[model samples]
Target: MENRNRFPHPLFYLFPLYAIGLYFLVLGVINAYVFLAPISIAALMTMILLPVVRKFENWKINRFLSTFLATCLALSLYLSMFVVISLQANSIYENWDTVSGRVQNTVQKVQESISGISGVSPDKQLEILNIPPSALSSDSTNAVNSQKSEKDSTSKKGETKESTAKQNSGVKAAITNFLDFVGYSLLTFIYIFFFLFYRTKIRLSIVRFFPENQRDKTNKILNGSLSIAKQYLVGRLILIFFLWIIYSVGMAVSGIDSPILISLIAAALSLIPYVGTVIGYVIAMMMAVVSGGETGQYIGVSITYGLAQFVETYILEPFVVGDKVDLNPLVTIIVVVLGGLVWGVVGMVISIPLFGMLKILADQVTVLKPLGYFLGQDDMGSKDDDFLGAIAKKLKRMFK
Candidate 1:
């Protein structure tokens, strides 16, 4: 009995092994991400588009045709957005000169304002930043003349050939990257199609992996995970639509050019959580400045973003997204940051739903239920009973 007591728990003995396995698991995920990302994204996409496929089936459409139609519909929607954004981008390129001038003027005004407030002239600020005044100046008078005479006298032909070769290589690289993207997209759609077509088989196979006695529980957990992903994604799409509308109307009212383009970009960036929203605000502000917007216009953009965020956090999220994922705030932030570090923007976008699925699995498994509890929101308790609050209380007690 004394020896048994000394052993404590089985998990305590196995903790080192668990840590080693976890480290390898994370390393494997990072290394295999190139292959895994497409499948994971396809799985999520399948979950989102499953209902559409089901509806077609209900209308007596065959599974193959239904899957094809659903995939095409998704593809078309993505393509339409791509076309719109590309056209808007081309418009910006065409007017880049005017935009650049306005941006420079705005920057100058801002620097003057800062100089007034901080009692440091713009030149002094530039010197402190280690940037020469000529670098920021629109006129390249002295610098261009000095470089032109030297270039004309020495190695101009060789330099031109080298520059040309560099441009050619850059173009080739761009084309190759574009082709890779297209091929990956095609592969992802194929994965989605197969996943949809054989979804039932896949589900049964997953269930069969467990013992007969646990099969029912496994199936239940799998279904619950799929439900969480579906609801979260669908609700997020609804939220994005509303955000786009609000942002567009707000930017237009503020007299910003290409409001639709800016709003759509901002709405899309909302996928990355807290960081995305900040980026969207900065983008909108830059656009405002580039459009030669006055102080009132700047204030309008601020008010618009403020109101949009207020609506998103207070009204839309609570109602639309609800507690679908049901993750605690701390866990949400940590997982998002971890996901970003692991897989970049795509990882950040999918992290919440993926973690939500993991939480479901944890809740269903006896040994992991404690982990699920930690991951879940604490709606049942007051602030003091929550994790951080409890930690604060313990610290206070120890100090006292």
Candidate 2:
């Protein structure tokens, strides 16, 4: 009788505070991501390569040397992949004139096909859409004339040749991005080396955050998180390889050019749930279009993608990746999109495993168990399910 309702439950009060704190903490992290991205990436890479470092350590190698060797091996493997892709890309670029002409011809055919469906030629459709056909023709003519005049003026001026403004801008941007990437990669390697060397101290530091009484639980959670992260990474690598083989064979059989390269790219893009598949399909479709394949070839590529995705989703992911993360469909989609918004594609690729680690910790902590459950793959009675059940019960009672 003494205002029991006003007092409510302790959890009812504390839960809100915990949730609010976590929200702000995440917001702060996202805001500071630019400064912290290197550290985060390094930590993730270290976790992935820690086993190799430990294996070397077990063989009585120096930790410093072991860490360096592990880092170098990982880097070399990735560099090899990059080199292969670069060679293929260079080959494509070297034949860009032919490729571009083929692409333009294919695109024109597509426009014609589209126009057929509307019973109007592409030019008539453009006119209907308030785009003058003559305007487009004039623009193309003007572009050609300008290029001729520019060459004449340059020859007259006896000046050294220079790339067009667009080409120069593209080259400058590409160089800038490449330099930034190299710098960040070096920083990440340094971080990985130190992280491997001080791995024990790092674990102890994390354990120290908890009370002495809870140190064991904290240690267990951390160790479990690391194991799960490693497992997830390995599973992803296997899945990528599997998809690559399947896709490459199919594309090659269908006579797609650069089958291996296209398959490798498409398989890698399968990391992000739902969205990645769409993007990969569009990319393959574009490649097929540009490769000058007939309609049958396009259908073959689409069918190949569809089958590979079906197997990947149903067989590979569930069985190979397993249920370690246990994230629900809704949570996975939301986390992927949020990761993309915060850190672009890299975020999307790494977000799931990181969230899985968070889910593991949440499950270990009593106050956060509900959040862990919510993020889980369980199909228990959700809020809407409960509401519907309640309404059904009320209707039954009224009828009775």
Candidate 3:
């Protein structure tokens, strides 16, 4: 037999390299945007609103008109809400003295209640808090002198510590915060323009990535991805509305002052994933605890939050959020944590959807298929239920 030369296919071999390189390139681009977070995020938001722009186009509106109208309307709504919340926050701060007093009394009461069964005296228990003596001795100093001394203490010591810490941290925080908000806003706006303008080209480009024979599959996946994104966003917004309703009802039922106002702020922030609502709860409880000297109400609020999350995860997610955007819980956790670490709150909120989109992309590419599988929602789990089930089925068939 004559010796024959056999060589590997170039594109076949290159496909793996292409996938790996493409992913890293994507990651690098994302990192640059993280560094330039605000504008980048703004661009992202604009992309998100591209569908809305298209909606206007269907009405025969000019792109510039639609873009300007949609963007301006969004900005106006946000600013108005921002002003209302800011005013309410300012009012709360103005009456902080009263709020502080009420909180202190409630804490003391809780401490006293806890301390009743303790071996230690209230004075000893005070260090740990939530356990203390029922009695608080009167100060030896006259009321006026005590008030003066307290003012000095609050000014010189209490504020100094917090202010110094914030000052040390504030420079980076302020820059990052400003950039985060403004940058994302601007980026999103720009992205919206480009996305809307090149929407057809983008769709065609995505389809062209596949071989002609598989274009149908690619088209299906692309449409599915976009549909899922829309579903996810709208569902999240719906969940936020539900969260606001739950929080507002709880606060109102508990008879907390400023329930409606605080609820409004909380509801607005609840749109942020995870940390946002927790921050809201802490603020809401603090307000309640301080304003009323009622520790029970604060505890109730915390309970309600826990219950709400439980319902959301088990009930709301399945029914309302839907199973279209399936992603591994582990991946979800990692993405959320890493995004928050790299870009803070905005990163955390969008990480899930972004990762979900990436998963869809990976599914379309063979070399990246392993990554898609890894990021999949299904797993064998620690117990290997699939293995056990297979064994049991085999055993039953054998016996029969």
Best TM-score among the predictions, by candidate number = 1
lDDT of 3 by residue, 1-400 (tens): 2345666679989999999998897688567865566554544455456677879989999887887777776677667777777787788789877766666677667767767866665577765655423323233234444556554875768678988898979987988898777766656556655665667787898788779999887887777677767678767767767766777788777767677677776765654556677788888887677668565777767776776776666556555686656777677778877887766777777777777778887888889999999888666365346664465446547656
Best by lDDT: 1
Candidates' C-alpha lDDT: 0.89, 0.83, 0.70
User: Runs in model 2 with CA error above 4 Å?
Assistant: 1-27, 127-166, 380-400
Q: Write the per-residue lDDT of candidate 2 for residues 358-400, one digit (tens) a residue.
A: 9999999999999999988777446555654465446547656
How would you encode candidate 1's per-residue C-alpha lDDT over 243-284 as one tens digit per residue?
Answer: 999999999999887899999989988877788899999999
TM-score for every candidate vs. truth? 0.88, 0.82, 0.67
Better of 1 and 3 by lDDT: 1
Better of 1 and 3 by TM-score: 1
Kindly report the root-mean-square deviation of model 2 from the true structure over all alpha carbons. 8.8
Candidate 3 worst ten-residue window by lDDT: 132-141
Q: Judged by TM-score relative to the true structure, which candidate is superior, 1 or 2?
A: 1
Cα error, candidate 3, residue 376 (Å): 2.3
Clashing pairs in 2: none
lDDT of 2: 0.83
> Which ranges in model 3 have alpha carbons more than 4 Å from their true place?
1-35, 119-222, 261-284, 293-296, 299-303, 310-316, 379-400
Model 3, position 73, has a per-residue lDDT of 65
